[model samples]
Target: MAQKKIGSVHDLQTILQISQALTAERDLDRLLWLIISACSRLVDADRSSLFIVDQSRDELWTKVAEQTTTIRLPMGSGIAGTVAKEGQTLNIVDAYQDQRFNPIVDHKSGYRTKSVLCMPLINSSGEVVGVIETINKKNGKAFTARDEQLLGALCSHAAIALDNARLLRQDLAHQSLLHELELAHSIQQGLLPQSAPSISGWTFAIYQSPCEQTGGDYHDFIPHAHCQAVDVVVGDVSGHGVSAALLMSTARAFLRALDQDSTRPGQLLEQINHLLVQDMADDRFMTMVVCRLDESGHVRYASAGHEPPIVFRTENGYCDENVETDLLLGMLDGVGYAEYVLPPLNRGDLLVLCTDGVFEAVSPHTGEVWGMERLRELVRKQASVGASALCQKIMESISDYTDHSPQKDDITLLIAEKT
Candidate 1:
């Protein structure tokens, strides 16, 4: 049967008014309601719906009609979904007789759906973003060709409005996330030692370089209240970014609270490890080293799978690599850490503690790792300099070796020189 031409000047006016309203509205929910209301009024239908395409899930979703519950259907599964998938207008006089129409919704809601007119809401790029569906014409007749033309015009405006609203929401979410990261970075930085501690007969030098706003590497100097001994700690948490930085902060707090003059370095680390294993996730872990240095140049240190300290003996003109290894923290409970006493440092001997990033930095041009041998040679040559100056020299060497490649990990160095 040929379609009835029921065109009217008032219909054109209604579409123009709806377009103006949609252009001004930015809220997505309100905009969707406006579109659905407009669709029902324009076509004189019993009910109407607007389903937005969710490309990520390969589905079409709509909210409203049932109050809180959202309706989702696979692409090309039903009348509205088929219109969205094909980017075409579907006008069926008898919805039950049509092969593309799914009557499950009618069965569930107990509402008879005799006629359905589904139109694709296409963007300026000719891509269908959604579908405008209207069911059961109020006049006891199928929707005419004039109704389809009016709905198509309204849908064009609705698509543009939806695109703008979605983009605004995405930009706002991105800005909010960036602000949160900035706050997190600030808090992590405040947890670190601000300045080197002042002590006679010892010069301390420290530096930390993070590839991002925050890093997993941590270092601190905690002095004993009763004795002249000072504890130096350097830790590297696995991975980078916010999660690693959070773990680094937690470990720092645990170590500081457990630290005592009577407690050995190994005993302190064991306590911290047990706490971490209980609190942390299975994939996470930390490698750390703790060393206590006295005014008399006597030292006791312990390692938890961390890189051993490089000792520069000024008299012998040799570098002593004597740090014993053990299992890293947060891997398993009941793990034991061993303490090793280094040969007492004579006058002018320097001890260097660092994370793996100090030596494992890769060169972009050469594709080579600046290994331990290069670091040992550099320390031996720069043994005569003060602790602070030697740290600066090593950083310079690392910069030169990588040829200004982007740093992939956190770099931390703590140098203690016996004066």
Candidate 2:
């Protein structure tokens, strides 16, 4: 049980062999076990533990404990934690005499602790990534200064190896997640209306821009062949990215399947709202507007906490009117939606529905928003153009206003013009 002088040639060779073993293993768990094994054998300790830092939780956790059970401790608590926090070495001759020692672990494990030596594992960037704790030296003596030096050398090698392995694991996980998101984005794009609804006397233009691989914005035009009417809907989920994209997909499916009945846009929205409330989380909801246009040029629309569409009327001195707003979807069950009738559009009139991302876009340089007024002005000026040209011109204006800064949210707009 006597500790051998680490300056000996055999001990140096053993250290070299341990370093090789540590470097060979890339799996974090196996590498951790190797580290503890090397520390126990090199220091002639009864048991050893390696605690890795979890910066997100600000805690130290051991995956390869002597008892084969995981242990978590606050960053600055206990002997191991103190060493990790201060980035210093601690050698305690008597565990019971040390104020920093927590006896709860000893009580639970039924292990009598005597001498303790703990040292920080600092990465190349001079940051403490973890700690090495060796408990109860086999000879029943305090860990010597020589033990600290030898263990410190081992920790230096272990830290760099551990950091590299951790980075690789994180990169692999991130790549996997990105691949899944890209696949989901592809699937989500297919869920949207593949082609704009082709109706006589009407021209439709649709556009969507997602800041991330996935977005919360959704739009679709479903035509009723029997009724000779088209249902146009635009909805925005609470947040952007994966969660919102999933919810958007669900809503799209529900809308398609449930719109088979001959209900008005308001009644259909109420039905969709009840279904969304059951599926959405409490913190999440959606803003939506649905409008049905008949061949006779009659347009009846219902809104759910969504922004009003801009109606550019050439007959009214090129002015724009915003439709009445109402409560959003998925916020409350049994909420009724009121349908409003818009004046039948004459030739060259425009109806534009959009999510907030379009007008609320912030200018990167000036920190000013391209507000609703600017959007309304742009629509009025461009209203005389074809439906596709109008949507394109508005998108160009937004790009110029924001100076092409990275988009923060999903942008969507649907323009329907009476030709």
Candidate 3:
């Protein structure tokens, strides 16, 4: 009865250790290793080993701790294998004397086996992935049921924890990247238009967001034509990160300098391209749609291998207007930045521009693109709405299609709606 009471007490202690292991975030690995190592001490053994089932090989592979490396033993080959295959515990007083004992690993690692205690590690599914085997029993003693009970409980929780750690590790890695990305995101936000310009009868808006909180997309609005025309820039850098963001800042500065000339779109681009080609990396380039929207609503724009802005004529039932395509900036020095002239704009005209992310959303199940045509229809049907609402609706559509998958690239939308 005293022994029985001691066993119950030991089991409770094991349960508490499990609870503590589960609750802790930092000490889980130590807890698992400590429990398995303590199995031999608790049972008065020389050393211990743990193994999980490998269904593919139909064998019990050794998972060696650096402090206690185990050798791979085939199923039914050694004392550990027999115990695991039988789903039972074995306490052998003389391992070397037993013909079933495999001497190969001991021969390799230079450890002798005198006594053995091996048990199967079975989960709730009744499938065995591993075995826990101990040796020598320290001072010629043998293992006890108490040791079996303690180690059994430890193994159950350890297996679960190990599986969880593998999965949680991925999440941890992503979160670490996210934290770094937040720093980049802060820098990106600072580069945007801090606030709206003070202009009469003009509505200005800009939006940029990465699929993963940081990417190469950007947008800005600035003074142009001696403060007579407004310079609007929407662009995507060639890649993501602080590097791309730095390039974006450079682009903004160059655009501002070019805006001083009251220049044509193509001319402004040619000049910026000449400067960027010298500064940008071999792979670094920018796709930009720059436009000058004047107080009278006459628009002149240029493209540098970027998606054309959709000029929605509200009076004509949301007709989407597009200009000609051109080469991307930074592709070569002395490139032309010719400007594209727009027709005289009327009241309630909307210009929609964006990066590649919004149009690249694919259905998770069917893998179909959400496409730019659908995006235009959404804007056309909803162009009368303000800038914020239009962007929100388009984002919602993309999310619905992709199930909120990571944004493949940075997304930007700039609205130069003439009221």
- TM-score of every model versus the real structure: 0.90, 0.92, 0.60
Q: Which segments of model 1 are wrong by more than 4 Å?
A: 1-9, 65-68
What is the Cα-based lDDT of residue 376 in candidate 1?
87
Instruction: Tell me the deviation in Å of residue 86 in model 3.
Output: 10
Off by over 4 Å in 2: 1-7, 314-320
Candidate 3 residues 1-419, lDDT tens each? 99989878976785676546543644445644654665665566777777756666767765444345656766777787787688877767787888878787788878887877777766656766567777877777666666677667766765565555545776888999888878878877887777767655568676667665656777777776465877677888887767788898888788777767745667778888888998998888999888778888888789999888887887777665585878898888867766788786778787778887778768888988889899889888998886667877888888888888776677777766777
Q: Taking the tens digit of each residue's C-alpha lDDT, what string does model 2 give over 1-419? A: 24454356667898899999888898887898889999999999989999999888999998787874789999999999899889999999998999999999778877788999999999999999999999888988899887887898899999999998998899999999999998999999999888797887688999897899999999998888888889989999989999999999999988999887847989888999999999989999999999898877778899998987778888874654655877888999999899899888888888889999998999998898999888888887777787899899999999999998888889998999887
Q: Residue 413, candidate 1: how far off, in angstroms?
A: 2.3
Model 3 per-residue lDDT at 143: 63
Worst 10 residues of 1 by lDDT: 1-10
Where model 3 places Cα greater than 4 Å from the true spot, the runs are 1-26, 49-133, 140-150, 157-187, 199-201, 207-216, 224-229, 236-286, 294-298, 312-323, 327-338, 343-349, 356-411
Model 1 C-alpha lDDT versus the unseen true structure: 0.88
Full-model lDDT, candidate 2: 0.89
Best by lDDT: 2
Q: Total backbone clashes of model 1?
A: 0
- TM-score of model 1 (CA atoms): 0.90
lDDT per residue as tens, model 1, 1-419: 12222346677788999999999998888988988898899889888888999999999999954222578999998888888889989999998899988877777877888988999988888888888888889998999988888888888899999888888888988999889988988988899888888876688999897888789999999898677889989999999888899899999989988997337999988999999999889898999999888988889999999987888888899999785889999998999899999888888999999998988999888788888899889889888987889999999989988987779999999999998
**What ranking emerges by TM-score with the best candidate at the front?**
2, 1, 3
Deviation of model 1 at 172, angstroms:
0.6
